[model samples]
Target: MQPIGTTLKQIRQAKGFTQKDVYGDIISRSFAIRLESGQHDLTAGKLFLILDRLGVSANEFRFIQNDYQATASELARSQIMLAYDQQNFPRISHLATRYAHSDNPAERQMAVLANVLIMAFDRREMVATPAMAQLWQQLTLTKTWTLQEIDFGPIILVLTVQKKQPLAATIRKYHLACERYVSAEADPFHVMDARAAFDLVALQLLLNHQQYATAQQFKSQLLAGETAHFTSDGNLDQQLSLWIWEGYFGDPTVAANRAEALRQIPSTRFKLGIDTLLSTWNKRAAAYHQRQK
Candidate 1:
């Protein structure tokens, strides 16, 4: 908080504005001086008004206030990724332990996500734990979506299937997420990738449940956002998989182009040929939809 005050003072001085110009009638100049000197606090509404006057968003203020450090949410994500890469289950377990008790709802949700990923890596059967159930309720009951909440589509679907849970809440979550992705918070390319991954995962889930109508809707979504560009093998594989699904729920002609799309990637790390892998996916995709007949 002190840092925020000091940083605001620095920015105020650098911007060549006298305190009165910025605070003008928001508060007395003497109080504003105290606010800048780290001797006082302002309500959130006041802080935002002051920041707007200072030509900064709250996000920018945080970056500057933290001396350009990653926000807690970003830091938590990094820790989970690094620990997962090292197969450091204990590290993640500790993270879950710590974050589970955090007063922040986001931290609690992340703890559930961490535990779920750990279960996945250990090849343990995924189940909707109490934490996950609570998370599902939170997401479902929320009036609006944040980028993180929107990103929960995949995990929520995974647990919903495992628990043979009601689809109403889970499907609603996915739909809200679908709508939110149009304004995704990440970089354009990565947002598309993330959106693809979410849609593909949801599409497969609906297909596996033989919910062809829902599957087709997601198929339409993937098509609208589809691209030939990819930056990694994972992206290529994701695209290939979408095309296979395309054959089943979309234009067969469009799906057949996956073979040519395969040529875009030089090779894969897998021993099985990429074409063979895709051929198998195409067959499976066809067979799953054939159940509709």
Candidate 2:
């Protein structure tokens, strides 16, 4: 990777920002010159502040510096998801802190989602904390949630239900919005991947609250819309959870067989965020027949 200062200077010049303009109280013009010349290195927080003033995200700057030329937010988000998949709490917490303090709302929302997912996975009793309520209101009111942010919907859904909030209609609305998002995607792979992730989340939330009717509704719609793409080849956590859902609301025989199959698979295959849900699903499956009778 090129020196951060060199990369910063390049981006600043490309943006037509003079040293004074880019420095703008964040640092002295001399400091900027020294930084660019590799004569000095700034602290992480200070570097981020300078980058913020330069109108370039740290992720974007890093990507450009590394010659990746990819979307920075997407790359960071993917890394966060991979951390969740690997059950790396330390990494998740670290990234959550980094993105939570980001100037970008998209990244901030993602950080909130990660924190909530971790809590949900750890089975922390969900109280309507001020932060939770604040995030809930923001997500509910904001129309900017798209692509990656769409995944945050499920985390918020689980939070709302666990907190005893009224959001059944909101849940349905989010599911519809996800459908629209998938429909608008140009790549079929992205569409199927998005839908599988979406359905997996929606089903997990609904089942957690014993909202079998709504779960069934989404399952039916998902099948109708993308039944062919809904195969075992999708995300493993999702596939296992979907099978558990099927057993809960569909034929017990199929669900039991699937759950047994799931049991044989290693728990490491699942996302940390979904482990609590998976455990709950299994426990629910065990008592489902008793409730029916």
Candidate 3:
């Protein structure tokens, strides 16, 4: 997609309108230049007025709006991951705006919620920005069902402290939400749907927080010796879970075990970045313990 500036310029030229022509009476020529350069914010009313003057239809504007939203959502997701890895919760909070402007409301909502959950898990001062608060309220009221949401509450709470503890109140809320759907005894399809929601949340909580021992325990409880069965089915969830375990618990023998397991899966079916992820974890884990020494 063309950059906003290019799109604006094209729309203007197609109409044979200069910046001055479009905003000559409303906004100063300097302001129009800033807007075109992506240096100034244009309110919806002002933007519509400019489009009207430029003879751009509402339909055309809708396409540009969607493009802008998509771009913002992608950028927001990248920024959030970067901030989380760097442990910069403040910056993660700041990047929430990029998501707020997204055209895909679902992605936008997930971005903001994910950021807040990350902050809460890191035990950072929860600065619930107005946008974050609004999105939270909307999700709660709408009762939107998503695996992302299901996984978020427990994952965040688990990371809040260094020890195993009771699930936080927020985590319990989501657990109850999951139970409500499961209780309906809906189709097998729905049962799998509920399982996906719960499983992903559990997997993420265990993996991200480096609770490999606890994760292994949970795996046994939940899967009941079906770990190999799940892994054989090329389940991404199972793969991720095992990867975390081997990465954290494995000695040289364990690494060999994991490598063998990876080999059994169809190479084309499973893109096991497990080797690379484990290698990185090994380095970091060594450095972490070294620093403690």
**Model 2 Cα lDDT, one tens digit per residue, 1-293:** 88888988899889898888777788888888899998888899888888878787776787888876655466567777788766677888898888878888767766766787677556577655565677777766777556544556557666667657665665556656556645432433344555566567666666666777777666554454544444453555455656866767778778767766766666554534445555777787778767889
Candidate with the greatest TM-score versus the true structure: 1
**Per-residue lDDT of model 1, residues 1-293, tens digit only:** 33567888988998998988888988888888888888988889888888999998787788878877877666776687557534577889999889889887767777887887677544467766788887767655776766765555556666676677765456555555545544433343244455555555566567556666666666555655433333463365467557756777777787777757775655434323455546666777767767668
Q: What's the candidate order when arranged by decreasing TM-score?
A: 1, 2, 3
Give Cα-based local distance difference scores for all models.
0.67, 0.68, 0.53
Q: RMSD per prediction, one decimal?
A: 6.2, 9.7, 13.6
> How close to the true structure is residue 227 of candidate 1, measured as C-alpha lDDT?
38
Off by over 4 Å in 3: 1-99, 103-107, 113-128, 135-216, 221-234, 246-255, 263-276, 282-293
Pairs in clash, predicted candidate 1: none
- For candidate 1, the clash count comes to 0
Kindly give the stretch of ten consecutive residues in candidate 2 with the minimal lDDT sum. Answer: 181-190
Q: List the residue pairs that clash in candidate 2.
A: none
Deviation in Å, model 1, residue 272 alpha carbon: 15
Error of 3 at 18 (Å): 60
In order of appearance, the predictions have TM-scores of: 0.64, 0.59, 0.40
Worst 10 residues of 3 by lDDT: 225-234
